[model samples]
Target: MVRRHWINLNGMWDYLITDSRILPWQFYKSEYFPFDGQILVPFSPEAPLSQVKRQLLPDETLWYSRTIQLPENCLNTESQRLLLHFGAVDQICSVYINRKFVTYHKGGYLPFTTDITDFITEDLTVSILISVHDFSDTSYHARGKQQLKRGGMFYTAQSGIWQTVWMEIVPNKYIRDVRVTPDWDNSLVRMRIRVSSASSAENASPAHISPTAADQTDSQGTVLAFSPDRQNSSNVICKVYPPVFLEADGLNDTLCQDEITTAAIRPGKGATLSIPENMQKSWTPKEPWLYPYSLEYGKDRILGYFALRKCDVQIADDNYPRFFLNNQPYFQSGVLDQGYWPDGLYTAPSDEALIYDIRAMKDLGFNMLRKHGKIETDRWYFHCDRMGMLVWQDMPNGGSSYHHWFVTYLATLLNWMRIPVKDLHARLLSRTDEFGRQEYIDDIRDMVRTLYNHPSIVTWVPFNEGWGQFSTKKVTDFIHRLDPSRLVDSASGWFDQGCGDINSLHYYFLGLPVPESDRVLALSEFGGYSLRLPEHSACKNIYGYKKFTTSEALTDSFSRLMENTIVPSVKKGYSATVFTQLSDIEEETNGLITYDRKKIKMNPLIVQKWNTKLKKSLHS
Candidate 1:
């Protein structure tokens, strides 16, 4: 659980890249003596924003060291525990506090935490050392779109702390996790709050939430205490702070107490909250309303928000499956957003930089963005939630090598021929390692858990173009069970399992795609009209499906594509359509915007007019 009180450990830190493999205590010793230099936190060493702008190879290990002084109030008592949270650390990592080993973790994209209460001393100022080893494409880890050799489509590999690092103080027994699921059909939100016990002994007795746990004011709330007299265990008590509603004004600074109601939180259990009739607001792209809530356990309070919305695929009046938002037909006109930057490869330069990308797309009249093959910082999703943008999240691809003949040309040919190829062979899909397949499952589950709260995320693409396609039915069921609320495109572009919600397709040179299945039809990817502005380009050798020298030519082609292809497809039961991209990356000059984001390659007026036409046609 995230708390209101925490330190943002995202500034400069002492960094060192070493060829030697040393133990955690060796950093404090004479070996690997002085730190090489300083690097910015949250940005990978390979990124320009980081001072240490160099990649750490597979053989070398990256080290980060910093001295942090705790505030006077953090874990002031013996009954409190200080938790250190890492938003993400690439590959494998180990942490040490004051030269003592704290914890170790694996995987690159998921967040992890360890309790540092026992590691702290009387001085309060503690030394932190993190050792990171990322094998990049060499190992079976989930490195989203990161390649050792940077080029078109693939990007530069990065390691070490590539995301936010922070620490929060909480009571020994506090709220560990809270999951809120919005039920639009019932007009109620189901909330499940999990509490952790402070008991240290394994044989200690268990406890349960009292029957009188809900609707009890602070005065009437029963304060549960941990097992006292245990060696290191102190009497940790908790107070149930009633949940309150706040206006969805971005940060939820305004309170909406007129329609406010409270529910009882059972210890080690879940609770349900019914939306007040006066405050029931369905979240839509037209009117996105977020219900901000703060659930507190003892002194630790964490802010959370939820939206009442749902996306489903159902048969329309035309006898074809159509996408519905809040039980009403909604067309998903989206752009492909490869969340990359000129300064930061995977990471955005700043929080505002992330906001700008989403805002830019929304301003252009597109309602959704397919985050291609990479997950983003939590704040990015928050902006989408507050600013009214939908997202179709893609799981990062990993495996040996994709079958060019089968996945590319042959698959495309078969798609044109309307022949469904059962792409289960490991070699065909590039999935050779059994361990890697398991890791992919684990990582995808973690990704779902991490981003489940955002209402903007309505769809999950497990395998795109059969890059690492394996066990399609199993994986698709797994993702569906993870968040039954969201739609899952099991096999997005090719190798359709015919299991998921949509029959997704990708067409590049072909004139827009038409519905070929009884299920919801989606042109998942199309229209790669490229305009390379040399001044704004990142690389010299530009690549795209179609190239245009002039902005006028590009805009005209895009306008024609939308008018003749996309708009007509909508009338032919095309429920959703995602254009090739929002911005260019590396050598792929196919974005509507330039790679550096300095200029929009197409005319805004033309693009907006095209989008307006598409929306009007779909709505009509």
Candidate 2:
């Protein structure tokens, strides 16, 4: 969701690194802490684009300082409140305004906001300060694929702010959040809009609002006004537009059409709007239709969008369980997207860079992407929604050091021998710490809540390759309760606990085989065929399941794998297959594209041709 009145605070900011023992309050007490350099906002210090070119250690603290002058019209203090928003900060952070501590946040993957209405001076100038600390992979803090040593699968560690920072001015009583759920089978859309109370309580939780009995009607006999169940409820208005087609410039001509429906309600409950059959459009990879809507509450307004689609698993005519999208069997030809960049590390260098990665895969005939072991910026999912791409979101893994002998080497050997392994050994899997396990649960809740509204996400992957895997049934049940709309891959790679909607498998060096199970079958990870271009490679030490000397050899081998193994298995029962990766990351050279994104390592036409063949095999 987005608002019209907001300022993007993304530019250069003064930065300083200090020992973790140094207290943030010391800066308020006239203590001298010199900000030695400037780093780009929304880019971690470890990223090349940040201009710091330094890694923040576990025992160090990264501090940021900036100042902004508010707009002249924003001085209506009695009616308006200023809210500061941070997309994400690594590990943990403390925020301050005008040298006074405001709030503290943990968990780096989700967003946090602070109401800084009282911190602005009379001149409308505000000084902001933020301090961050990241443990990286040194401890159990959900650090996904980030290692201090930084080699092989793990890459460099980054700290401080790694996402956008912004601010917005809103009325005292305003809408805080909006959640949209589409019911394609019923042709209805349900919404829950949370609105703030008139009280000036700082950071108080918003009250939910639902529609009450209709109090008034328009000349067309439509319910245009509704009364609130509670006396303090805010007057809310909703306008839902027809589905629009996205284009190169923006939304196409269909968006200019008159709104299909309008409803007025109050805070504290939910509302459902029915879409007429003629106006209803099912969202799919070939036709990514979206309905734009606006919510007006008191003096606040926000614009958002949603899609009508459904994802499930059902038995097809062949008497085999398969993945279904909108009541039809759909083969998910996907790629493993790590969401890394040569310049920005975790963050993409630009919005266009993120779009390029998604668009490139779609052009190559891939309909889905497994976001491996990391959460991305909201913009990435937004593009996926608008571009008609399916997503499997993985929760970032964190725990003490994993036992390679148990989780990797022995597990792989046992898997090849057709032996099933359970995730009961908490110590070996690095999930023994009670605090760490609770923190992992908290991280899961935050991740789902933050990304629940995205239509592109079809699966929730809790564990990957046995990293910090524990209580598979319990965690899967928790996710199901949180969101029953999507499928769950409780354990992606090694430890299949006989739960979840799919029996997911990973094949690197081993030959591909379709596992016989009552649930859907998915090759979650495979095809690590490497072709390194020296000029575009990030590191000389190459790592992949299969090494190729040239593009022709790699493309030919991939085609053979698809035509012989993948396509045939799809016809039998295989529902989905994810190629090892979208691009090279650090020392891992098993990607269709190079790390710099400057060159393609495989033949694009051959890749697209095989992908089309693989998808068509499900029905053939």
Candidate 3:
């Protein structure tokens, strides 16, 4: 969710890393605490861009302090409220304003906000402090692909804030959340808008989408009520605009567009907006169409956008269960996107850097990206949505150290032997922590809630390569309950439970095979051909499934792999193929591009030609 009016709180900030035994609040209240050198905000301490190239150990606590003077317009008034937002903070964090605790949040990937109107002083000067503690891989927290001892596929572990921190002003009574569900089969869109008031209880019951007009409640369960005598007795009005086919440069004004249809509905209730056949524009990777809309409740208004498109698996004319986009058989040529940077680690250097990655992949003819083992920021998803790139999002994996001999070596052997291994061995998979398992479930809910509005995401991948895998069928069922709209890859790579919509397989050391299954077939991971350029590499050590010495050799191998194996498999019921990776990370040289993003290891024309062949093979 993005706001038009907000202040970014990113820059130099006073920071200190201390022993976990030191009480930050006690020292803050006493007005005396040792301060360390300044570290760049938002970038973790371990990141090179943060200027302080140091890692926050598990036993250490990272503290960030800064002073902010609020604008007069943002100061709390009778009708306005001030809210502070953190895009994300690793593991756990606590916030203090004016030496008093305001809020605490857990989970590292999703955004959290707190109302700080009451904490504002008369002079509009606020002293803010944040303390963060990240257990990294030592605990059962949801740390994705981050390792204390980094090497091979795993990268350096980073802690503290790794995303934007900002503030915004909103009405006392505001739209808390909005969910847009596109009913493509019915040619309509369903919207669920939740509104909250200052007078309501702090903790209210969760709002469920119902056809009938019911009381409106915020995401946190606060009921939204208005007096009978209040003006505009109609609770809420929703206006949906016609779909716009905009050029890449025209996306900046999407939120300020005009509407074509209006519907009045009670808050928290579902309202369907039918799209006329003449105005219906299906969103695709070639032409991503977006329909903007605004929700107005009294003086509060918020804008959002959605696309009228559907993703499903259906038996095509070839009598194979193939991936379908907008009811037509489609072959997804995708790349495994790690979303990591050599400079920023978990974060990108700039917004343009994020866009560059998506655009670069698109230019290389990759229509989809399997965001592997990590959840990205909203801006990354926003770029994917607007750029028309389909996404398969993976839930970050977390648990104690896995038994590599069993989960990795043995699983690989089993996969090669075409023998299925049950995910019931929780201890072997390092999922024995009952509390950690529940936290993973909660993380799923939060991730879906935050990213549900994006139109580019087509699949949800719960488990990858048996990392922290447990209760595969049950987790797939839970994801279905959470969001039945998108397809789910219950278990990717190995340990298939014979569930989920896609029969996902990964091949690196073995030959690519056309799998026989009732579900859609996908080579979720394959073709890890690597060419490491020492000048652009993150480390001198090389790790890849297949090694190559030059760009020409890698490109030649890629062309043969696509033409001989992947393109031919499309006709044999392979609905999707995701290459090993888009870019190199740390010591892993199995990427099409180098770690610094300074070079594309393969010839673009050769890659594009093969990709074109993949697209045409679906119909041929």
Candidate 4:
């Protein structure tokens, strides 16, 4: 998600929240009105990181206003486009540039953009106004685990902008997008480039440019006609330069960059390019190699990088379905990461804060993390890619209230017997609403498309413990069609349709199961042992599968669990294991590290020793 010519519009903004339910037509006139107060950008109002720490109620509508000045020599005149990008905005969002409506988006977790070149004059500064409406738990939006009434397992709801806001100046005829996939078996790196249209916005109407005071009352909202002026791009030239790598011995290597490949491609249509086998370097957790690339087309040039690797499931020497990376059988010793912060609910405080979690987990000698139930910012996956950590990404769950008697209590009992419920039973799975079900499908596709390039993501979990789960087998096939590059966990914990790359399960109070299925056996969730330190916990409401008193005792229990259950299970066909979690969250005081990120609950050295031994035992 990184680009060369961009501005970070994340700092301060005028904010207001009212239960008045202001209509979009009133926005143009309200721009001149004063806001109630100022709040920090990219942090939800409910989060502590945002200066305005207040709950954004479902009945309230939030508005944000900010002014920005474009720097000199920033926009590419030939490309004739100024792209305004928002990292994310909760639920429904409407964006305006200088009183004129620019664009609108519905999803909460994905990014959106608008081309404002026609509306923006040669003068630098421009006004930006954003409106957001979030109905947490009141509606069937794909909010992860946020609830109106926060408590155990569910957290306080956050709304509005909770991620970075930025603007990128791209050439009118720039490379719109690129998809890179590794063909390790053929020793090649395949790339699909999407080129932007060559048309300019010069003839756009100016009547709506600066709307009159009389025009402000229009209920239909200002209509600014702007769409991608796509051009015939089949004849554009694309140049691919060989990758350059940093040396380990304090010496830089330039030999790799001497080779280059050039080709002609269509700008509007999809075109393919390949890096020769000899020039590619394979990527892995032990040696995370990134091949730096530079792509040039017409008046546009972009610099990016990609890793060469492959993920699959195959029978190993021991006759167990093993997870394979780069055509080699490897064990994914992982921990479940919920990815929530005490100060910043969904958003990390800073980029370094995101890196800290990934680096700390890798330092624990674990290779993978099952990102439980929620999707993280793109930078989180970027860090995992460069820091040599594998990831199992989960699509955030959303649906109606669960039928506790059937979906919760009875489901848990049936899980013990390794039985799966009829996933199509909409009521039991919390997917009774048809609109909510379709929205889930759409969100998963968008999630996959957005995170496809990250090498760290090896598996996609569509259903976890049957929360909002429906149409398991069909959904599994749909995901495979989206991207066959990675494995799919059809059902992570329960309601297993027996369709997917792995036979995934969850166990808390007893020993792990050794399933004799045709698929890879994965203990997706286990070992939620809790040890509450008064100084480190958020509250006295201690919750976990098992409770302990001291760090010493916790470490002792963790070591014994690995030695007696996990290690032997690997030999008995358990290909992957995800310990309950990486860090404590709210009342769930069962993590290797405390929630505030101040203390390591377990002895790092002892945990590291056991983890290393466990990894080595996978091969034995």
TM-score of each: 0.90, 0.94, 0.94, 0.89
Compared with the true structure, what per-residue lDDT tens digits does model 2 show for residues 1-620?
57777899999999989896466565545756578699998999999999999989998888899989886776588998899999989989998888888999998888988999898888889899888989888898898888888887788878789999999989888887776778788887766666777343322322322223543433323233343332233557877798876653343343477888777654445456778788999999889998988778877887778899999999999999999999999999999999899899999999899999999999999999999868999989889998999999999999998788888888777777778888898988899999999999999988998999999999999999899999999999999988878999999887899999989988875666556799999989888888788999889998887899999999889888887778888877889999989999999999889999988888899999999998988888
Error of 4 at 605 (Å): 1.8
lDDT: which is higher, 1 or 3? 3
Model 3: CA > 4 A from native: 30-32, 198-234, 245-252, 255-258
* lDDT, residue 246, candidate 2: 61
* lDDT winner, 2 or 3: 2
Query: Model 1, range 168-276, lDDT digits (tens) per residue?
Result: 8787767766666788987767665566673333112122344343332222233322222221322212222222232223443534443265544444433445676
lDDT of 4: 0.78
State each candidate's clash count: 1, 7, 2, 6
List, residue by residue over 533-578, the lDDT tens digit for candidate 4. 8998887898888999999999999899888887888888888889
What lDDT score belongs to each candidate, Candidate 1 first? 0.78, 0.85, 0.84, 0.78
Model 1 misplaced stretches (Cα beyond 4 Å)? 24-27, 198-252, 256-259, 511-515
Give the range where candidate 2 is weakest over 10 consecutive residues by summed lDDT. Answer: 202-211
| Residue pairs with backbone atoms closer than 3 Å in model 1 (clashes) | 214-264
Q: Give candidates' CA RMSD values in order.
A: 5.4, 3.8, 3.8, 9.4
| Candidate 4: worst-modelled 10 consecutive residues by lDDT | 223-232
